[model samples]
Target chain A: QQPVQSPQAVILREGEDAVINCSSSKALYSVHWYRQKHGEAPVFLMILLKGGEQKGHDKISASFNEKKQQSSLYLTASQLSYSGTYFCIEGGSNYKLTFGKGTLLTVNP
Target chain B: EPEVTQTPSHQVTQMGQEVILRCVPISNHLYFYWYRQILGQKVEFLVSFYNNEISEKSEIFDDQFSVERPDGSNFTLKIRSTKLEDSAMYFCASNLDREPRAFFGQGTRLTVV
Candidate 1:
């Protein structure tokens, strides 16, 4: 099943911070975060395994909580390049991914 | 950096016609997948291929849809008889393994008229 993402859309000024959350009903082996710009492919941001580890990329970071079957993505000091749609994909036991509806993040100058 | 490449950035075909979308994943990546996004919709997984066969497939992948690794370097998705609903951006992706990040192609905009 597809996960649920909170805050369907968010607007931020450059250097602002935002958080997007994803929650799933089923247990996830891993959670993958991706950013997609208009008319472009989704780019891999980071992957968080089930061990409750947190991973970061530049000003973006994510935490996965296995017990609650949830993951949160943090964007700090956002940049103009950060404007895009963020998708959280849950990996099942079979390794197939089910993506969320996506959160649209717009970072203004 | 290695990236997955897809062919025919845009394709337009009449309903009921067959269409094939091709992709070349990063070399040495063992796991391949096909996903699609209807205009303005979220990405949906279609199938995953490994070891020269489909490892898992979603309901979206039915009798009319099939995938093949025709050659060592190419992965393809074939729709035997397309429908209007099949019109979407088809993305091909691949990863090194089960837990690694999957890289996606720019996607082929399939317009079924």
Candidate 2:
């Protein structure tokens, strides 16, 4: 089954912070994060392979908790460019991936 | 930065017809994948290929859907008989290896009428 992402949509003023979460019923092997603008393909962000793995890129960061079967993406000092739908994809063995519905983040200036 | 490239940014085809979506993955990348997103829906995985063969495929990939790496540079997905529901943005992706942080192409918007 596909993972589940919370807060289907979020609106934030520029420079504000926001958090999007993803969870699954089964333990995930690896999790990948991506941001996609409308009418475009998903842009690869980062991947968390091991439990408790955390990664950051610019002001965006993500963490995975093995016990919770969950992952969280943190956007700090958000920028207008960060306005897009975020998807957390669960990667299984042999590179299989299942994507969540997505979390739409709108950052307004 | 080399990136995955897909051709025919947009394609409109009639139902019951055949369509082929093409992609050129980043040079030196060994893994290739195909994914699709219905308008306003989640991106769904269709198939993954490695070593010139399909490594894994989702249930969404049925007999009608086929993938082929016809040459060293071109990977293609063929739909034998398109359906109205096949209309979606199909994305081609590639990665180096098992540690799959795949780079995606611009995508082909397939509109089956």
Q: What is the lDDT of candidate 2?
A: 0.92
User: In model 2, what lDDT does residue A80 have?
Assistant: 96
Query: Candidate 2 at residue B4, lDDT?
Result: 91
DockQ score, prediction 2? 0.79
Q: Can you give the lDDT of residue A2 in candidate 1? A: 87
- The lDDT of each candidate is 0.92, 0.92
Tens digits of per-residue lDDT for model 2 on B19-48? 999999988989899999999999989999
How does model 1 fare in lDDT?
A: 0.92
Backbone clash tally (model 1): 0
lDDT (Cα, tens digit) per residue for candidate 1, span A34-88: 9999988998898888667898978899999857489999999999999999999
TM-score of each: 0.95, 0.95
Model 1 agreement with the true structure over B67-89: per-residue lDDT tens digits: 99998999999998899999999
